[model samples]
Target: MLLLKWSAMGDVVIATALFEDIAQAFPGREIHLNTLPVWEGLFVEDSRFSSVFAVDLRARQGQMQRIVEWLQRVRAGHYDLVIDLQCNDRSRLLLSLLWLVGCHIPYRLGNRRQFPYNIAPAELPKPVHTMTRCRAALEAGGISATTPRPVLSLPQFNHARVDRLMKAHELREGHYAVFMPGCNAKGYLKRWGAARYAALANRFHEDGLVRIVLIGGADEVDECQAIAETCGEWLVNLCGQTEIFDIPLLCQPARLIVANDTGGAHLASVSTTPMLVICGPTDPRRVKPLGDNVVTLQADLPCINCYRKTCSHHSCMSMLTPDRVWQRVQKLVQEAA
Candidate 1:
C-alpha cells in the first residue's frame, strides 16, 4: 500500500495524525509513504511507515529519477492499493505515467474525480475545515474514522540546542509567551502589523509577568528584529534561528503562544500549548490548527474569508487591533489559570 501526501509544512503537520487512522483501517498491511525531501525526515524514522520515499517536485532531474525508480518498485512489488491524499496534478501525473509503463494498480483511492481512482469521497460534507475534509475522505473511503492527534518527535540533538537557547536568553520554563508575527511573506495582508505585535510584547512584558519571545523564519527576520527592539530587553528575537520541528519543543515551555496564521502555529498544534491564532485573508475555519487549547481571532469584516493575497483596502487585518487580541489573550490566560 502506498500513501501520497507532499504539500506544505502545515498541511503535512495536520496529516501526521491521519497515518494512525489509516494504519488502524488496514492492519497488517505495510504502509509506504511518498512525500517531499524535507518531510522525509518526519516519516522516514517513524515506525508507522514500512518505507519512506522522497519526491521533490521542485527539482526536475532528481524528480524524474525518483519517479523512474519508484515505478520500478511499483512494478516489482505490484502495489495494488494507492491512496492519493495529495489528490493534485502531481499525483495524477504519476498515476498516468504508471499506466503508460503498464503498472496495473488495482485500487486507487482519492478525494477527487481524477482518473484511476476506484474509491473517493462520496457525498462529503461542506463547511468543514481542510484537515477535517481529509478526515472525512478517509472515513467515506473505508479508512478508520478515528481522530488521532498530530505527533512530531524531536531529535535528541535539539534538547541541548533548546537548553542553550533558554540559557543564553535567560528564559525560564513555562514563564514566557511566544509571538509569531510573520505570515507567508508573500503578502502583507495576511499579517497583523508588527507595530501591533510590538505593542502587545511591550504590554505583556510590563503587566503579564510572562517573558516575551519573538519567533519567526528568515522571511520574518526584519519584522522580528524591529519588534524585539521595540519591546526592549524583555523580548528575545529567535527568528530564523530555530528549526521548524523545534517550535513544538519551544512551545512546550511557553505560557502562551500568539501567532498570525503561520507554520509555527500549525507545528504547535500537536502540543498542549495554548495558542491564539490571528487570521485575516485566509479563513480560519479551513486551516486553523487542530489542538485542544487553541483559539482564533478574526476581523468582523464582510470579506474576512476571502482568500485573496493582495487587497487594496486590507481592512480585514488592519481593523483587527492589538487591543481586541489582547482582550482575548487575557480571557484565555484567565481560563487556563
Candidate 2:
C-alpha cells in the first residue's frame, strides 16, 4: 500500500499514528509512506514501513518530472492500493498523475472528497480520534486494526547534546517543566499570550516545584524572551537553541510539558511525560494530543473550535486565563507524582 501525508509537523505526526494502525492491521503488507523532505527525519528508523519516499514539494521546476518519475517507480512495484491520508489538492493531482501513467490501483482512500476522484471514501462510525480517522481509512480498504491509537518511536540520540543543554541551563534531573509558549508565527491566534505564560512560569517558580524551559523556533525567540523577562531568573529560554529533532529528547526528560496547540504538544504526547495542552480556536476533540495523560484547557466560548485562519476577535484564546491553565497543570503534576 502507498500512503501519502505531506508537511506541517503536527499533521505529519498525527498521520504517523494512522501508519501505525495500518501496520498493525496488515502485518504482511509492504507499507510505503510519502512525505516532504524535512519531515522524513521524523520517521527515519520506522520498522513498520518497507520504505519511505521523501518528496521535495518546494522544487518548482521539476515538479511534473518528479511526479512522473515517482509514478514510474510505483507502477513498476504494482502497489495493490493507494491511501491518500492527506486529502488535499496536491494529493489528488498526484493520484491523477498515477492513473495517467497506467498505474491502476484497485482502491484509493482518504478522509475527504475534493477532486473528481474515483476512490472510495472512508466513512467513520462516529466522531472518533484523529488516529482512528486513519484507521477508518485503512478499514475502507478491507484492513482491520486492533489498536486505534497512534504510536511514535524514535532512535536513541547521543545524550551528550541533552547533557550540554542541561549543564548550560543548570537544570537538575526531574526538576524542570518544558514550556512551549509559541505557535507558528503565521497562526498567532493559536498561541497563548506571552504575559499569561510568564504568569504561569512565575507561579510555578514561586512554588519551587518546577523551572520553566522555554522551547520554540527562532521566530519565537522574542516571545520566549518576553516571558523570560517577566518570570525573571528561573526561566531558561532555549527558544532558538535546539533543532527540530532535539524537541522530543528535551520533552522526554521533562517533569511535565505546558504548551499551546502546536508540534511541541504532539511531541509531548509521544513521550512518557504528562502534558497540559491549552487549546484555542481548534477543537480539542479533533486536534488535541493523542494520549490519555494529556489534559486540554480550552475556553467555553461558542467561538472556540472556529478553525478559522483570521478571527475578528481572539476571545477564544484570550478567555483561557492563566489560572485556568494553572489548575489543569497542577492537577496533571499531582496525578503524575
Candidate 3:
C-alpha cells in the first residue's frame, strides 16, 4: 500500500491519524508513505510505515523530471493500493501518470469525485474539514478508521531535550502555556498580532500560568522575539530551536496552547493538552486543529472566512481583540485545571 500526501506540514500532521488505521486494515502488508523531504522526520521512526519516500514535486526546477522519476519508482514498487489523501491537482496527475504508463494498481482511493480514482466516497461535500475528508476516503477504501485523533510518537532524545529546557527554566509539567504566534509567510493575515499575544501572556501570568513557551519555525523568530521582549522573562521563545517532531513532546506537558491558525498548532494537537486556535481570514470549520480539547476563536463578521490573501480593512483579525481571546482562554485553563 502507498499513501501520498505532500506539502503543508499541518495537513501532514492531520493525515497521521490515518496511519494506524491503514496499518491495521492491511496487516502484514507493508505501508509506504510519500511526502516532501522536510516531513520525512515525522514518519522515519514510526513503526506503522515500512518505508518513507520524500520527493519535492513542487520544486521550480526539474519538477517534471522529479514527478517522472517518482512515478517510475512507484511503477517499480507495483503497489496494490494507492491512497490519494491530497486530492490536489498534482496528486491527481500522479494517478493519471500511472494509467499513462500502464501501471495498473487495483485500488486507488481519493476523497473527490474525479478520474483516476477507482475507489472514492459517493459524496465528499466541499467546505468540510480536511480530517473528515481523509476519514471518508479511508472508509471508502474499506478501512474502518477507528482512530480519528491526530497522534505522534515522541523520540527519547526529544524527551531529554524538552526535559532539559523545562528544567533550565524551572517550569513544571502542565503549568506553562505554549504559544504559536506565527504562520507561514503566505498566511500572514491569519496572525492575531504580536501585541495581542504579549497582552495575553501578561494575563496568563497574572492568572497564575506564569511560564509561557513560544514555539515556531525560523519564520516566526521575529514574531516570537517581539512577544518575549514585551512579556519579559516569563516567555521562553523556543522558536527555530526545535524540530517538527519535538512539538508534540513539548506540548504534552503544557497546560494550554494558544496559537494562530498555523502548522505548529496542528502538530501540537497530537497532545491531549487544551489548545485555543485563533482564526481570522481562514474558516475554523475547514482548517481548525483536531482534538477533543481543542477550540477555535474567530470574530463574528460578515467578511469572516473570506480566504482573501490581500484585504483592505483586515477587520477579520484586527477586530478580534485580546480581551475576547482571554475570555476563551480562561475557560480552557479553568477546565484543564
TM-score of each: 0.90, 0.86, 0.95
Clashing pairs in 2: none
The 0-to-1 C-alpha lDDT of every candidate, in the order given, reads: 0.80, 0.77, 0.86
What is the Cα-based lDDT of residue 20 in candidate 1?
Answer: 73
Predicted candidate 3, C-alpha RMSD: 1.5
Residue-wise C-alpha lDDT for candidate 2, range 122-221, written one tens digit per residue: 5666556566666665666676654423466655563567778888888876788899999888888888889999988888788785578999986688
Candidates 1 and 2 compared by TM-score, better number: 1
Give the runs in model 3 whose Cα sits over 4 Å from its true position. Answer: none
lDDT of 1 by residue, 70-132 (tens): 677666667878888787787788887888888879988877655867777765556667677
Top candidate, metric lDDT: 3
Clashes of 1: 0
Worst lDDT window (10 residues) for model 3?
Answer: 145-154
Please give the lDDT score at residue 25 for candidate 1. Answer: 82
Q: Which candidate tops TM-score?
A: 3
**Each prediction's number of clashing residue pairs:** 0, 0, 0
